[model samples]
Target chain A: MNAAPPPERASPAGREAPRSSVLVAERLTRRLEGEVPVTLVEEADVQIGRGEFVVIRGPSGSGKSSLLYLLGLLDRPTSGRLLLEGEDTSGFDEDRLADVRLAKLGFVFQFHFLLNEFSALDNVMMPMRRLGRLDADARRERGLRILRDLGLAGHEHKRPSQLSGGQRQRVAIARALANDPVIVLADEPTGALDTKSSGNVRDILRELASGQDRSIIAVTHDLHFASAADRQIEIVDGRIVPTGTMATLEAAAAAAKAAGTQTGAAPAS
Target chain B: MSLHLDIAFSHLRSRRRQTVVSLLGVVLGVAFFLAVSALMRGSELDLVARLVDTAPHITVYDEYREARPQPARLLWPEGAVAIRGVKPKAERRGIRQYRRKLQTIDAIRGTQAAPVLVSQAIFSFAGRDEAVTLSGIEPARMKGVSTIDEDIVAGSLDAVDTNPNGIIIGRALARKLSLEMGDTVSVVSPTGNVRAMKIVGLFETGNAGYDEGQTFAQLTRVQALMNRPNVANLIVVRMQDAYAARTAAAFIERSLGYKSVSWQEASKDLLDALTVRNVIMYTVVGAILLVACFGIYNVISTVVLEKTRDIAILKSMGFHARDIRLIFVIEGAVIGIGGSLLGMAMGSGMMRAVEQVEIKPPGSTESITLPIYWGIDQFALAAAFAILSAVFAAWLPARKGGRVQPVDILRGAA
Candidate 1:
């Protein structure tokens, strides 16, 4: 589905988002109350267009995961607005937000988070059953197809406890795509994986984003993972620091190290 | 099955031991409920049956319920007729036109009626005197109306019909007076007309009082001795359906103008006692089921506590709070219903065991088994209580599970 771009260089500007964008965050913020109040995401603005793989990269405690959660409609923003296909979601109630999450967006957490009681096939069918767009047999057929496509065909009956770490994560992804949501959000998708498994997950995610024309927004500290995305938004403290390309993210990480500050993760080095 | 039901099954299966233990609570509770109710109901029915067997269903006495109005008061309307502190004329005390009233009573369907000439008499032998209640009955009609036929241990009731001067006395009285069959005793009515009557039949009703004080004789003989010819004092009735006695008695009193008392009216205190017993039985049995409900509540609350993260994940997966609640409620209902079915079977067995216990009451010569009433409604009652307890037990934890926020769990796990 990635027809070669029509020869004009893709614009680096994100603020003037086109109508084809899937999710838009307009200066969204999230605040947590405590003895000492915390701001998880502060005034973050980003636009994710269809068929794009976008990354939010930062150091530890940089609020990248918080921003991704807000964009995915898992959490209500403290101020500013988020739009899904140009509909403002700031006023949506909790149930309505869940409906949006079920029908429009999907999620993969740092842990696989598959229900331990269910088998891999049942896990994949959970979202489809919830959405109720398909009957039981059809849901089963579609779930098997998704699992088979992700190379878990024979492992359909295996419980989450029986599957390897990477296999479990793939089951989680299969579950997320069960309803064919247009936007798939991942928070540290490779956070619990080994080197080779994380590489496998990254490649699979890249293919799913571009090959199917589905937008993917993921948060990670892995610079190598960020460099593969079409666009990257860097977070420092709670605010987004925009970047133009893979080169800009590499340059920023290099500059941080030279200036004696913690840099974005570069596992490849 | 629905998805929530499937999930509920899985959750219970995962904690099978805990589920079974809670289920045991319900099973024992329901079993005890059925057994206790059956015993209580069975004993009540047995007591009423014995009561009905011993007494006439309805008794119409010769006496008027109210004093007969004087002719002067009847004739003087609004004339300020005052007869205060005046005694009525003491006329013949027996019922007039008694043969006609007996025929009227016999015509009433679903009843057996017999006229009896009852009088207080004294039996004297060798200068020893004893008081007795002489009930002179028509042997054929008495056979149909009175349980005395069954209590006769020696000669049948027909022996008294054969000999005009024959008397059937209870064994206790025969023993006390040292009289036997073919022995003669002088029976003197309260008005002093006396005759030497031979004992032709002997009966022992296992009631010491009735055996000692009550005796039976031919109706003609008692009427002659009492100087109450062509008159009877009581008409004892046995109905086809004992419960219909009140209405029958009322009709009899209204038509015959005699005071007809039904067994139910005669024993109001006994019926009231049975009703109070039933109330206490239900309260104690209901408390058993309530404790079973608490067991269910404890188990479900623990399941909710242990599965909080799972609930959070389900909520995050677009499951509504109600769906989560439904899963746990279904779990509770499953256990409750399962336990009820098992308990019903066990309770039936328990009731059978109870029915086999033999006890001879005081002063009884033979052993009798306990009465067991087997009513299907007790099963329904037990099931209703079981399901209600289970549903209510599930509701508390279900509401808590439904209100769980995914964000809270996710943040804590992170």
Candidate 2:
């Protein structure tokens, strides 16, 4: 399994990704240390290239979000290595990893976790202020420009509670792009939005990848959302299953369930 | 830093009632600390100042703390010699070679010495007899060493220079005898010698017993009447700095071979009581601030708990754990500084109000306003203690806040 090439490289759609890989994982695994010892993600191999929009799809409890967290440096792997912008991050401490995340990556959670007390503009400027690479005037100006570009020009002063669900998610995205991160990771970005708002958020994330030359990795259960991504990776039972064999494996698992016993499907030869 | 402060202020503002209540605790603690300490320290200093100003700083008595060694003991060397029931030799009771001793004491810097021959006497005026203490003093020297010169209500202490037989008696004594200035009274000493002494001056020391019994005459006149001429029994020394009297008295006793007692040594019991009082005062004040700090700890702890989600979001945004901790600590500091400033002002106002209260003490004829010490150090001390306690109180909760794992909170929220 470790010798197998990453599924993105074998897929015809992956040929469109530029050769520059922004993030790569080599058999990364994370196990929760407890008496039960739950394996959240195991042997996850992935490659996200520049300007590529990747969607991770899996059933509930399949560790789809867990894998995205590992790639985003929000969670450390128990074993194996993760590389961000060609820098091996397994040796980095928590603070060093956070620094890298602040400088190179952004995140949008399932809930648009904009600080409720702060105005939308201040929320967007938070990452910029934390990075401290830009002066106050530049940060404010850039924050205003980003919010305006996201169609939230006049609503920058509104608090999160005052904004609509879709507007709040847009602010979260604006905040994610505050420091001009090389890659943006979203977990169920449009999960809480209506159909129209979900479509709007999907378009914005796709444009951020294709138009701005930044990578976007999203974990979504919405097939309509997944269909718009440049490539799709499917995970099952904490392992990434190749798209070619996923149907046969699902059918086998359904047959096993029908036979009055619950077990994992055998791997396709 | 500004971002942390912004979040801290936002959190505090969101819970305005709790924040203000914690702030009020600090304010009241600091105000009461200043007010109570000022009163305690003020009364202590006032009592010490009265004691220092009214009495001699150091007194050199014509006495020895230890017995003189016998000639036999001096000669024995290592021999076991026992001398029993040996009667002491009779001697005149006075500081021997007084003029030379006076010159020696005069050589010491920052000191003024007055020679006094204190003797027991009886005053008889118009068939009334009063037992009294007759103190013979040189008018010019006594003026420099004694507060009696300031207490003279009739003739001056220098009147004894013109009339060798003149005596300065207290007003209470003169009133009891129905005697006026220029009235002559017969004074008889323990040695049976008698003299007709004119009442030339009068003084009132505000001490009824002393005013009724103490009499002052010229040194020569007292010596002549007592039949012990040239004998001065006591050397009263006053210093420029009363606080330096203990060391000066020790040095004087070493040089002069007499028992020297500083004012502080004489009133040691009173000084010890004041020290105990100061300890109690500080403890009570410190406890007040400690209680105030508990309020701070409570408020910050609640904020940390309530803002757990915010903390998690901030952490995911790449904020370090210290940043989360800093926001809460800054909240504590803001309350500390703001409350301290207001408390100091309130305490000063309280001090001013206390200073306006006038009361007549028992046996005192005049009413005096309460003393309120406005020392800057006490204000600074209160502020420093309150702020430090507030920070310390914030630190406990801050460590817990800093230990918050973003993953745990994020997972829980999800």
Candidate 3:
């Protein structure tokens, strides 16, 4: 039987669409350590809808992280059209990019890289204080609200060194959410968590993407995590294989529930 | 901006150890500069003060090169030959007549006319005798022209005014003869005349010129002792204008025939020495300020380097380069202002301390005291130098900070 066609990603109308896609890629490519350059997403015409749960997935060294970085504006793409909210960001200088990152975007790295010197509340307030428009009371109120929202209210005064790994990651999440960013580009949000913590982080990501109406483009190699996403793009050797069918919920349910199931959707192991 | 200032202050407070070490050089340099300058200025005050004690600001004297015609001689009528074959005497008589003409000049407000007797006097007291120049002065009139009133330490000038037989002797002379107040001293003039006088007061001008070689007496008494009537030697005139003394002297010279000089001319070397001292003091202080500026530059430069990351973050967050520069400049300026004020207080206190200590007179059986002079100008200059040096010191390092790139800062490359 012929595989189902890929779903077209179009920005929703009327809801004051995201500046553009939280992540946009046209032939997004990155190269590491000598030899031929790896095309992370070859002419990968993808637009992340506002408040959409878009996931990029592939095996290790498949350029998933590279695509996330290029989209997050953390790393530059060699040759690609990156229109953040329909504005060309390819020529944006570092300072301007930092402004976009501060006012328009937030990032959740795989390692939960929180500044070690400050307490969790201070870390949450870092972006707002750095931006410098808010007074002390305002910054404190905003930081505390975010920490409480992330279920880490009691941990607000604790330093990162004083917190557990999960708590530290939650603090990082609170920090990213502090300034109320339009989009959260989390690179492997649950990549380092235990099974329970991983599910917790995944559930939070899903809620932020669907419930709170924030565009989330998370990069992950876990098929289980990617499977629950609204949409997933599988990259291999820097290119998306357009011939493969996009597996729907029915297909996913059948693959997991049927006995002696011979599945063609799983990667050829 | 106050916010940044608050931040800067708190930041410095946080790094108290480094701030103290850094500010130590500035503090010491300011204090040293202020103290030395104050002492030099004090020396100038002392020199001027001593000169002001002995030097005559205005001398109204006999401008006549020769003796003036006495009132008794003037009775012979105008152009009458009073002396036969004594042309020098007659010429002296004419010049003396001219000196009498100066009395009519209205600008001569106060005159202390005295016969400056140049004859060697054998001043014998307690069997010890020495040659001395007797300056016969009207005690009341001398107070208007010089600081002679301050010279009297024992007895009184009023006694010299009341008693014609009274004389004012120097402290050195009193010591040399082992004499005290009320002791008799015999003055034997070169004319083979002798007169005994009682010592009424001891005067100390703190200078050998006045203290060692001179004695004061009533002008009439000295005139009678010399048997010179209607004939006075040099007349020391005191006038209303201290600075105009030279011009007044020149006027007197042109009007009459005697030579007259100003206090400035009399003590030119003393004044010159004071000026040279002032220049040397400024140069020494300037060197201190220069070194302080350089030290501050190094310290502030190091601080800038340490704060480069924070500066970058500030800039990226919308702080302008000018603002960052202002922070450091303000920091330096604050250091300078603080150091200057503290140093001035310290220096002024030091001067007061010097004044409080009494140093015994060396080689003497008495005590002597000196005061440390403080002036408004000295403090003003020192304070201005410190503040200017600090601002100038901030320039180089502040410029370097302005050149820092945000990209490099975030990357830890700055």
Candidate 4:
């Protein structure tokens, strides 16, 4: 995989970011302290712009999900600083961080982790309820609208167990947009979905980024899914490895689609 | 209504069997607690009522609580000289100025005092003699201060006033001496005076010793027979409130300079036993609820364990640790409240069942029902303890659940 190195662009960490950037990370590192210390993410620098769709592509155990977690404010970094919308968040307490996450960030995991006891609409309304910014009627209306936009209008009252793989993934995507977050973080969003569900989830995330002006950061091993994003970040051994731009990756993916062949085996999807 | 409670209800609904089992434990605990405490408090109050009714609320004796100081000792402050082996002056063993003392005692609010001249005597009928304590009483005054009138088996206490030579003896004494009502018997006093008296009444107090040894007659007749006319040695006081006896006795003793004893003071040992019994009763009942609370702890702990993944997801979605804790705690509180309400109903039923029990004690002719006190305090206490225990049991596991780090669980699951 380490062939002729592509032209190195100026690292976003060293240069002044544009006013549209929503999340900026400067050499963020996370290490698990033990007898033999392990580094999950090492001095990683990332800058995600508003309305941008970015994908973290890497081999297994390469900290692709770890970086997503740090960016989502789900885990604190060992040594570096992160700024969300020009606000320094390294000094915020656990409760304050949770508040920021609730107000500004959303998450979609591989398993379509909807509460089993609640309906699809109820699961979608969980974030809105937690944020408490909207009234009950407003929350219900917004949840229904989001589910309807995701082509799940009639299945709003159905449980995750009752829905198909593609439908469940769509419900999860609807849940991720419940609070109309500034950014959505996805960790292997389609890792448990079939090919059709994976394509559906990728297109929905792409539309959320472009149409609603919400930034999206997803970690995936599927090259075809990565090709749909505006940018791709490759990581190896906890370090980001610069890769080809969106134009080249899209052209390659289009050719692969025409030939009905995949360039790489998808992991757990 | 709130989010945490909504989540708690959903969790409990998902595990209906376990929730019902824990709830039943609380219900049984509260029911048994109410029933046992009701019975215990009932019997204690019954015994106290009997004690108050059958005896004087306060008794003023002819003797003093303390001996009088010697004149020399009073005159010489801090005297080095000790008065040794000093004997009290001999006089008539009776309250001095009995009319004035009775008037003073009766002046106290809610109190009624009756003067009695008690002396030892021997009753002889048909060549058989029995030693008994003879009481000289005015029927009108004694009626207010004693329940002896209510214990009469034949005739009445007023009959003594109608016939000055009339005497009232216990039924057991009548049986032992082969005496009947209206029978003439000779009463001999320690003063060497003998007189013939007619039995006007017979009483059976249920206490064998008291029934066999006590006899009452008209004041003038007994005073004249004993050769102590106009001398009353004891004043028995009955009060409206039996519980006020202790303070009343103290006040009366201070005023009259005589030894005054309350029924509570006389039965201190029995009352102390009852208090110890109450402590044991509550501890045992509380322990039953405590054991039942373990069922709550088990169910909540299992929920926390099973819901770790859900907890992690909620935390990632911005639910705080306290919110997570509140969800589980609400689960505990719901069970507690539900169980308490149901338990109170069950306990009321149990108490009603206990009230139906009747028994005939040995040597007693009539059957008596068990005393079941229906005070509201026990019900409140049982419910409060059960709910508190249920909440407390939930607290430990809730704290554990709240402290669960979302990152750890998320990382492991991923």
Candidate 5:
């Protein structure tokens, strides 16, 4: 397992290497409740490399979301090692964990949890506003840019209820990426989306992962999404099963595409 | 901080019903607080003014000793202890010197001499004679030195000067004697020595103690009746500042013991009642403010609940707990300041309205009419109380908002 790990390159003094894989968790464990006390992840060491598209696939109770939460520093593990941008996370309290999460990670929930009060642009601008360094014009500019990137520029003034499900999800994604976090963690992001909407969101996630070279660890039950990742990790009964990479998944997908072409025009389009 | 305020308002705006409820709480609280505060001030000012107008700011009395008969004085026991009194015996010999000492007090306006005589006198007015103790004061000196001048209702004070044997009396006393101005009244001493004085005027002093039992006459005449010429038993002093009465009286007593009493010390019962009323006013008004703050707490707590999820999300976004608390505190402060201003306006308006309604005394009686004057200090006090209540009410909710955990609330545990 290469226990000593690699000698990571030192970031330039006073400058963090952009797109650093800022989250690491090894052998993470969580107890749900009761005397039995289920361990969510045991001896599970996962490295989400910089710019890597890491997809975790599992069934409903496979603790896939739990691992994502642990990596995002939203929940503490009963016992395990977690390093956020190479700093040991065990010593971090709730407040310190919040600091790490706010500075380094973004989250997209299965349900698009948009704060219902604010318009889409304001929702995206909220984190920056709370941080309070930027003036009004700067906040507006940054918010518009993120909204524009998410294809939500036109819907920026609309409330969440006025937007389509895909648009709402995109807004949530924009809000998540507002801080330009080092990593984006999505748990069942497409679970509420239709096939078309899901594919659009999947495209957005892939772009975020590769073009921006932001590390993405998405939890999904979708085999195709998991297979399409730079790496596929399977979890069953709270432990990860070793898996292969995008090259193998691409070959398999291509074979499936070819086979499907003879029968129907590739499902939707 | 501005960012937190924006967030706080956004959260508050998100729940319109709750925000309105909270704002209503603050408004009512402030209004009641200010109203009660103003009422208390109005009542207190009226009482103090009444006292200041009718009562002497300072009074002086004779320090007396039980005169010993000849045998007891000649066979006086060795080392016989004498009681120490308000004035020492040596100072009592030169008592007139004490009146001069009162002049040193900056607020001493003037002094009036009254001979408090113990001789039994029969007062025959409207064909009846009743025995009473006689008190005498010079009319001009009384007008110059006491509150008696303005208190005269029916007749001129100069009338007392025109007739050497003239006297002024309380309306109740005059009614009891069935006498009017210009009616001659015969006063017979216990020794069968009689004198007649004309009814000069009638006065009403509001207080029952003075109105029922007091009569004023020319000082020298009463002095002759008491068999002491050019001598007064008691001297009443008036001061420019009412608050300085007690201090001045103390200084005068040390210089001339048994020679003076401040209005407060003379009328302890009345003064005590005034003090108690002041305390009760503060307590009752304070309780009203407390109730108002309670309402504010109710409204803000609901606000805290409605914003819990937003607070969690904000916390997750790296806003500290202190920041969350500050947001709610700002909200509370805004409500407090607005309510306080509103309360002050409403209270001042109420006082003005009250002052405008003329309270006429019964049946065209020439009596004292009291007015409620709005003082600046009253408004400041009410505003201060309202603000304190508002801040206090907001404190608990702000703390609860701060303590909310982001993950717990997002997971619906909060």
Candidate 6:
């Protein structure tokens, strides 16, 4: 899928979700098996549609990342069905699920997780090669273009170890966008970056959802990053808690909206 | 996919030192395997050829497998007949009408057959008398079955045909009887038949016992002296394919009612020894590759352990478990191909060195080069084994890589 146009600088239009949903899930649950059986995600119903920047927020053990993984098709739900682009994925095998993820979903983990052995260009070429729509030359050109767009123009030949933390994360973002997936899933994209790099990463993620027409789902505890999203979900103890009881989160969002600024990380309790 | 190979090669190239260390194991294993296999098989084949060449490929004797039943026992269907001794009507002992049997033997394809009369006799020359085996043969036909013509040391085998009363004796026998070319020797057969024969040829076959105890003469003269004219009691047959001797001999025996024996049957113990030697060689060589496989397993398993995050990342990036497995297997294939090619070259070099080595065997003056077998089958075997071991070594870690769950690693890292 082609990326959406640059996000409008006008009033936010993400709360109105009645347009079209790219991914739909019903009562999805993931339970770990052991002597002490633990449930990671408990009957979570969610919808991620076009042009929405959704942030998953929770305490340390709230299964926020688990929910994102379930939605990203990296983890299978124990007893619920997931629909991707209006196709049922409940019966898809491992390989088929991977194909769907490759074609439809992109992921950016907390550590940036760029393959250390490969150059920035090759790392971005991975997903494009997996899709196999373009020949090698086209894939390389597409890879270089994505890197250039992400401000990694001269660093294409540098490995992850040679690049800075922010550059590496940008390379990861470039990789996520290589195949032009319908949705991007980031498990704390700015979790390990400094304040400056974290701000740059947050801005990049926001533009991805609002401007590029591609939906984004990120897991984060940063109140500032959470407040900038079109929608914020708070998960507590493997369950999604309603937004009304989370006063600090609501307070942060309202204050950031009133100030007309992009960050809402003040007064984090 | 090329992606798999691409990743595989990157992994190997990233860890260059460990890759070389692991590669050397397979290289040495394969090289030693080829070198040792060449030496063992080369020597064994040389020994077998020498043994096989020294005797006729197939020999047919004039005898029935079992004697006929007594007349009384044959006549009484239900009665028990006991006899202490039994004798049949008098009959001639030699093969009757052997010329006709020779014609039937000559009709078979892929074989050369010759008739011979073998009898024991005592030889007397000057004042010495020693027992010897006198073989009566047609010189023209005997050459097809035996290598005595090539081993002729003093005179030619063809001289027996031109000389009317010719006898070919071994050099050791000539020394024992003080007989040389043109010397007449006296022989007394078992039936008291005596004859004086002129020695026309001499042969030396490197076997002291055979050289001292065997002699050859014209078939017609032997039959006349032994009082069994126009008869041959035995036939020696040689075939183009030594391995096909059993079938050919079986055909001859079935058609002629004679006891046919192939060289294979006569030297079964020696052949069995060769088979046992092969088993031992393979087991030892297999152990070497197995050890090399363990070395590969160690290196790849360490790579898997170290690169767990890379595996998790690739899995999260939408790579299938099969892709992970293919990457590791490709790594193994790289090692297999590289090791086998270099090992064969190194092994060929070792074989050349071995071929240049000279040794003087016991009881011989001239130094001879050591035997080295160079055959293509060994190369194929070394390569097949190298690849198999390499693939097997990678299996454990590849499976581990395929089973990697990105969430666990991510959770742990978080």
lDDT per residue as tens, model 5, B1-414: 767677667666666676666566556655555555566556666777777667677766666333433443467666474543334235323234433543443333444333333345678876677656566766665665567778888786667567768877788777787777778889876656678888888888776667767777766677676565656666666766677788878876676555567877767897688688768877877777677667667767887887677677777667677777788777777667777777776666766666566665776556443355466776677667767777877888999998987656544531
Error of 4 at B301 (Å): 0.5
Superposed by TM-score, candidate 4 places the C-alpha of residue A152 at a distance from the truth, in angstroms, of 1.1
Q: Residues B67-164, candidate 6, lDDT per residue (tens digit)?
A: 76777778995798787767765777667788888888788787888889988989988888899998888989999988888999877887877885
- Per-prediction TM-score of chain B? 0.89, 0.93, 0.72, 0.94, 0.77, 0.94
**Candidate 1: stretches off by over 4 Å:** A1-48, A57-103, A233-241, A244-269, B62-112, B139-141, B158-166, B181-184, B196-200, B218-221, B229-232, B244-260, B360-363
Model 5 clash tally, residue pairs: 5
The superposed Cα distance between candidate 4 and the true structure at residue B365, in angstroms, equals 2.3
Worst 10 residues of 5 chain A by lDDT: A1-10
Error of 1 at B82 (Å): 12
Return the TM-scores of chain A for each candidate in numbered order.
0.85, 0.88, 0.80, 0.84, 0.81, 0.86
Q: Is candidate 1 or candidate 5 better by TM-score?
A: 1
Alpha carbon deviation, residue A77, candidate 4 (Å): 2.1
Structure candidate 6, residue pairs in collision: A4-A212, A4-A213, A6-A211, A7-A211
lDDT of 2 by residue, B44-141 (tens): 99999889878889998988877788888899968898888988678888887888988877788888999999999999989988999999999999
Docking class of 4: medium
The whole-model lDDT of each prediction reads 0.86, 0.89, 0.69, 0.89, 0.70, 0.86
Winning model by DockQ: 6
Segments of candidate 4 deviating more than 4 angstroms: A1-19, A244-269, B69-86
Q: What is the TM-score of each candidate against the true structure?
A: 0.83, 0.91, 0.60, 0.89, 0.78, 0.93
Cα lDDT of model 3 by residue, B167-278, tens digit: 8888887887888999988998877898889999998877776687778887677767776644555555555555566677677667655666667677778778878877
Q: After superposition, how far is residue A157 of candidate 2 from its true place, in Å?
A: 1.3
User: Candidate 6 at A156: error in angstroms?
Assistant: 0.6
| lDDT: the better of candidates 4 and 5 | 4
